[model samples]
Target: MTCSPPAAPGPPEPPEDAAVTTETVTEPVSTPRERRGWYFYDWAASAYNTTVTTVFLGPYLTSIAEKAAGCAEEGQTCADLHPLGIPVAPGSFFAYALSLSVFAQVLVLPIVGAYADRSWHKKRLLAWLTAFGAGTTLAMLFVTGDRYLLGGALLVVSNILFGAAETVYYSYLPQISDPDERDAVSSRGWAIGYLGGGLLLLFNVIAVLAGDSLGWSTAEIARWSIVSAGAWWAVFAVYAIRPLRDRPPVETSRSRSVFYAFNQLGRTLRELGSLRLTLFFLIAYLVYNDGIQTVITLSATYATEELKLEQTALVPTILMIQFLAFGGALLLGAVARRIGAWKAVLASLVLWAVVLVAAYFVPARAPLQFVALGAAIGLVLGGSQALSRSLFSQLIPAGKEAEYYGIYQISDRGTSWLGPLLFGLAYQLTDSYRISIVSLIVFFVVGFFLLLAVPMRRAILAAGNEPPRLL
Candidate 1:
């Protein structure tokens, strides 16, 4: 972690945002210890993303669901499981579970954020959510045999908890860092997350590869890997939350009223009209981030099905991307310091567009070409996302950070469905993964043009925030 002398003792003067909220303004003092704690939280949480969400749970869940559907073996194609008289494909079970989780997050996280903002116990809320989420994840160890229903329920609950926790977690960004420090701080957090997640994934990969020799079955390996992630998250989060101190509540009134929080949530939604540039930026983020997420989600499938790359090649590529992305996040932050976060994000978008186009042309049976494409993807992935978060933090009203971020998180989670839908449609029509992959370009193109129309400095000022030093 970067070191600095202690922050000057005393609250700084409130900014223009004080006029926008009814709460007493307690100016935040950014400190190295708090920032380090914040970074560790990112590190602690990312194991869920890398190990369970991205790597293991989907296929493992599918296999269990297949067995429940009466498949003779895990790898064989099986009949759909009919739940409540509705036929559900085993292959799509994890996808559906993820969708359900995101849906739950859409309904719940705004209220979570709103309550967090009003309460004096933000740190406690984060801790509770993390513990519960980790507990649910750890429960996967008991989802043995054909207990597909239990697995699905646990996955949904855990994922929703993760998103809710993340909303509370992200609210800390604006509170812990000044405008000028946000980009670098956010970037470093993402980089550390990549490092933490990568190291665990590497260990899991080694365990999986050595499973047969170690007398462990594939199922055993997957189960242990998942539980390891939960343990890692729970263990690391202790240190992550320790050095952090809670801010003064945004308001002491309505501290006990969910209805009041929801009303404030509605007001926040209506207030977006006046924060036009912030709204526009959210729209742009929703579109482009969908494309980015779709690409990340579909890469393994495309490489395996389209290019016929084996797990031997595919797994290593994922590991490479994870590690490289650490440096990539830092590289983007450094670039942001020189050229500003806005331009840096735009540049990353252009890179994303290029990566997709290049993916469309990758030759069949070409592992080398696929690995090279993944390297390019690794370079832009975390950088673009980290910078986007920092940039959006600069565009929201100060005391209302959690309220505005509630909307931002909703957009982040809720809008990712479109790109995948479009991708599926393209593949259905063309019978080609290449065509399906390129179809996502529409998202980036439209988002880029929409973002160009946004006046960044004006939006920051309009939100009653001073523009960041670089911007």
Candidate 2:
């Protein structure tokens, strides 16, 4: 983390996006302790993303949904579990849950962020959302028997809260650091998140491994592992919540009411369209990030369903990916320093395409083959996401980073709906996981072409910043 001081303490201010046409406002540098605090939130929250959402929940929830639907396990012929006259397959249950959360996020986050920028309660809001989300995650422990809807409700609620909290938390970035230091700080934070996630995952692996020896069922271990994730999220979050304080809530005339927040959002959207390169970049990020997120979200499900990998093999591989991504993010940062963040991201996108294609053809029962595919994914996962954030930060017009990033997260969650929806639809239609896995390559390909059309120099110039040093 960088060792600079924080922004001068001041009242909250309205977004000055009109100045995007003129000059950029320079940012005050942030302290290392504050940056570390920021990084810890990522570290804290990642346990859920790592253990529950990625490694355990997919298979565990699939099993619950499958059994509820009167099937032994989710497979090519698993029965569809319908609720309210709509068929919900085990393979698609979590996907639909995530898509539903994304829908809620797109509606809720921008408004929350606008309010956060205008209010003094940013940290308070972040804490409340984190606790609420983590509490919902903890509720997963009671999702026993055929109560899949209860489980799905908790997961979807948790996912929605996670997105809302992140909108406020991410707004803190530009507040904490200069654009020049953002790449390194962001990369290190990703590395730290990976480390935290990997360590927690390691403990979960041990729990699962020891369950049989301790006379505990595998399902019991899975439930405890999920419960542990919620505890971890709630505990580590205190690190950021403690030392960090929010800028005094600026109750400007436009910010004094909910109606004004919506109007501000409307203006931001209208003005956003005029910013050509930034708009294109968001579109490209939405497409490519959809592919990235889908792979991360579904990798466990795909392995369990298509590859037939046991939990013992799957958890260890996930642990390996978590640790490897730590190094991968840092390594990619160095490579970006030598080349450029954008080009490095492009290279990672190519690797993502390769991983998807390989997943389509890889042997279903081969543990080593799945591990190999996972290693390749780990190599690109952290770097691609970290660099994308750092790169986007550089293009944000000053005084409007929070407002624009609200849109950024919206785009992020919005496109997320597409990739998983497509994945689930493909599976629903064909009962073929291979077809679903390979289908994501279209996102990377389309994103690559669209990203190529973005002119970085003009984008930076329009944002009134020096052309990005990291890219």
Tell me, by lDDT, which candidate is best.
Answer: 2
Worst 10 residues of 2 by lDDT: 1-10
Q: Residues 229-269, candidate 1, lDDT per residue (tens digit)?
A: 89999999999988877766544463557888887778778
Residue-pair clashes per candidate: 0, 2
TM-score of each: 0.88, 0.92
Residue-wise C-alpha lDDT for candidate 2, range 1-471, written one tens digit per residue:
111112223223424332321132244556678888999888998898898878888788878888787886434466778877798887799888878878777877777767666665678878998999899999999998878888888887888787777777777776776666677778888899899989999999998888888998878888889989999999999986776655533233434466777777787777778887888898999889999888888888999888888899999999999999999999998888888888989999999999999999988889998899889988998998888888887777665666677777764522267888999999999989999999999999999988888887788788766675657
User: Cα RMSD to native, each candidate?
Assistant: 5.0, 4.2
Misplaced by over 4 Å in model 2 are 1-26, 73-77, 248-251, 254-256, 411-415
TM-score (C-alpha, index-matched) for candidate 1: 0.88
- Largest TM-score belongs to which candidate? 2
Quality of model 2 by C-alpha lDDT: 0.80
Give the clash count for model 1. Answer: 0
